[model samples]
Target: MQVTQTANKNVLDRVFKLSEHNTNVKTEIMAGITTFMTMAYILVVNVNILADAGMDRGAVFAATAIAAFIGSTVMGLLANYPIALAPGMGLNAFFAYTVVLGMGYSWQFALCAVLIEGIIFILLTITNVREKIIDCIPSVLKHAVTAGIGLFIAFIGLSNAGIVVNGATILALGNLKDPLVLLTIVGLLLAAVLIAKNVKGAFLLAMITISAIGMVAGLVELPKGIVSAAPSLKPVFLQALSVPAEQIFSLDMVVVVFTFLFVDLFDTVGCLVGVASKGNMLDENGKLPKAKQALFADAVATTSGALLGTSTVTAYVESAAGIGDGGRTGLTAVTTGLLFLLSLFFAPVFTAIPTQATAPVLILVGVMMASSLKEIDFSDFTNAIPAFLTFAMMPLAYSIADGIIFGIISYVVLKIATKRAKEINLSLIILS
Candidate 1:
């Protein structure tokens, strides 16, 4: 009887271990799903740029999607952080629409720029100067960055939903008199209702449900006809390399590099600080474990994306949505990374997720961002002015970093004028 009891105990212990392992795997999978849903918007907009670049549009897209999958997956499993990576929305537009078309630079030259910028980012990560730079920013401005991004994201949602329309000829700035706008408003209200009712995944589920209803009601446009779809497989990369080696080494290369480095640096910093705080990743000192490792992952992802013939890579703030769903660690990141890989097979499906559907998630994100205003030390004008400058400039200046710079300058100026120079930290003043 004693031997039998021992055997049974051993079996139960093994079962418990198996169950624990399964739970971890499930958590990681959930994280990946959240990550993929956040990044789906990129597939819609990025394809247009590659199509115009005189490169094989199909190949460029395939490579981009693949690289995103690889980069995010690696970041999740290795760095164990819940951040999503993809060809950044703004950088891609700048690369394709502005740099290549607007400035008349060749696509090869653009790729070179991405490469150079990515390398610079990597070096910054290795030296840990990036953290120092982030540290030097006034805490008020740091808080403002998250809130400003939230507002900016909400603006993007409203604009995408067609709820904020252009004016007619006379007024030239009135609301658009469109049915799509009305439909989206209805959807927003529905989302609010779901949240009020305590529905889980209220934001995401509301967007999907409303979009499906819109489609059935003839409020949204379905593709007109069967489009010639490309196969979802990896094709030859570096075709641009064959075109001309000499063109890669040009003055244009310098511009591309700087653009990639500058944008990704601040962008990633904002995401890390923003999401980490929300996710409870920060320690008592506000430091995160392996933070430089995570930054390195992001820099490497951007460099890889450029090599894959896409825009500069960036960390997605949408990863916060997963945190909202109870994601606590790297398990969530691994899940997000796996979902990005799976998305390649369902590219067309991802393409079909309407902008209206995603808008609400961003709206919710905006709300989360605005939650920071309470943290601002509004009692002091020195803190208040800089914080206010950062918050207001995000949308008006049309750049987050620009707003940050304005806030820093204003804070320093205000402190000096108020005879509070001693209160100002030398490191912050110098860096700002």
Candidate 2:
């Protein structure tokens, strides 16, 4: 037993640089659990969304788990970063609603476009072009992106908990009388208190406590079964690769590929910068070390997701939860990946977790990340305007890429109008 323990410790220390990052195995494991619990909703949500695109629900479930496993594992091992990757939410919605339904393309064709986009990403990363783009981002904007994602995540949590509802004019308060919403409020308060008290594992404890209460109160249902065999992926995997030759060269196909590539590029960049800033992982130059590796992992995940029968895969912003839990190394990502693998067999049990339980964690993480806003120079109008737009537009527009687009455009316009064009780099001008 002692020998086995020593061996495991050595491997973790060597592979994850655990000591260098000031994280221990136990902390990484806990952070991994916290991160997984917060984002696990994607497994069920992805299946439902893709099924709308006429894919098999069971197949998509297995695909989602597998893609997550692959993405997280690659990120952990290759990038040595705590970030987790999965089939992204908005991109999946685009695949279902716009690409397949609106454009009237087959699901297989959409997968082909995703695959091509991933290839493009790989080429860009290898050529160091993507790294240049990341380097061009102003430090102020990076801080804003981090805070922006916090608001975005908080918005998601509110929507999930039914605290924010769709109104005739805009978003309105949900029914305060609703039991689930009430439970979520209680959970949020409990989490906030624990966080304030500096309790370890506060987020995870809150989730478990709320989930248990939900189950007992009949707000959440118990799993029907604990374990089940995974569904076959051969059917969808083969279908994705069987793209027609004519479709490959079609103008519509080019447009679809460009759309996928564009969205994934900015989304990954925003998430990387945001989560890195929160962890203090960015260097003095405002660049993430091993960024190429992170981008490469995302590219590989997207390609692999296409083959595994899912939509575009990218780094998840929920990684901030792990970072907030003191996950400073890849070991956290590895733990999350391992858990995803285990979840493949225990899908029913994991899917049973109520959104109200996870919602509190998201809100708390948002609060943690929003703290980065203090780093921005809010006194300067030129800096403040773009920063505020980057911070607000994320949740408001319901798209990270769109928020980034608006931020960059505004930043460039303000700089040039103020006759500070020299402060604006050539790359920013080109990007604009």
Candidate 3:
């Protein structure tokens, strides 16, 4: 037993390059725990969103944990980056609201689109298409997309918690005196205070707090068990294959595919560059080392996630929490991955989190993503108009696809009409 333990330790040390990265098994494991704590809210949040799109809550909970495991594990072993992965927030919202609910497509059909998007990303990354694509799209639009999704999902969060409702004026405030709305309000404030204080795992803590209060007040039902077998994946697994042949060629299908691809591309690039630069992992040219391997890792996880019945799995910015906690190697990520695997048994606790309990996280995540808006140059309305339309249409039109489509179209038309045709690239023109 001692010899076998030594062999396992040696393999892990070599495979994760712990010594080379100046990290140890103990530090890596602790960082991994930090990473999981920071982003653990996804187990509850993802299920709440996907369940609205007519999925099984238990199954999505299991799939979410499993996919995060695959994503972070691959990131650790393949790219050797200290970043974890999970079903992204914005893309999942788009999947549920814009594609399935608004566009009137089935959730299975949307999953098919996500699978295609992942496959395309894999091919594109292999051909070195990511950098060129990133360079082609204007930074203004990218910032706008992020901010738009923020506002859009914040709206969803508000709606879910019954803070906002359809009224005589088409939209109105819910009765603040109501129990659910009041609880959601308290959760949001508690989460805000926790975040303001820079507390670790603030979101998860807020959710648990509100949940406990709700249970005592008889607002949320008690769970049967805290730890049990993972739910069956049969409901959501392999759903992409159920997509009809005609869906592959339709105009809406193309639009859906482009939205997923563009958002995933932007998100992956932004998270990697942000975290890598923070970790001093960038090279002399301001490029991430082993960039292709990292991209391929994210792509593979995304494809596998769709097969496992979840939305686009990409690198989580929450990994930055772990990075700040002294995680400098892939072992940190591998540790995070294993924790996600362990979370499978706690699906009952996750699934029991009321919709209102997750509302604060959705709102706070929106605020974080929307910060990109400050980077946009709004001094000129030429750039400002498209940017405004981009973010505005998302919440107003109730569709992220509409937001992207309107932004690109308005951008191309505005630029050409203003004698700035040179600013519009071939890809933007094609996208328009």
Model 1, which residues run further than 4 Å from truth? 1-31, 168-177, 221-236, 239-249, 422-427
Candidate 3's C-alpha runs over 4 A off are 1-61, 75-117, 232-295, 309-339, 399-401
Estimated TM-score per prediction? 0.84, 0.98, 0.69
Q: Candidate 1, residues 1-432: lDDT per residue as tens digits?
A: 999977764553353232433334444445456556756777666777666765566766676776677677666655667676778777777777777888897776676677768778889889997767666666677777777777777777776776654555421322446666666677678877876786656666676687688779887665444433544434435533443555666666666666767777777777777677666666665665667878888788877776677778777777776665445556566556665566556665666667767776667767877787888899988998888888788766666666777887898899899998886787768756
Q: In candidate 3, where is summed lDDT lowest over 10 consecutive residues?
A: 130-139
C-alpha lDDT of residue 243 in model 1:
36
TM-score preference between candidates 2 and 3, better one = 2
Candidate 1 lDDT (Cα, 0 to 1): 0.69
| Candidate 3 positional error at 430, Å | 3.2
Off by over 4 Å in 2: none
Q: Write the per-residue lDDT of candidate 3 for residues 75-168, one digit (tens) a residue.
A: 9999899999999988999999999999999999889899999999999989977755444557677677667767776787798899989999
Clashing pairs in 2: none
Error of 3 at 135 (Å): 2.7
Q: Candidate 2's C-alpha lDDT?
A: 0.91
Query: Sorted by TM-score, highest first, which candidate order results?
Result: 2, 1, 3
Per-residue lDDT of candidate 2, residues 367-387 (tens digit): 988998999998988889999
lDDT, candidate 2, at 71: 93
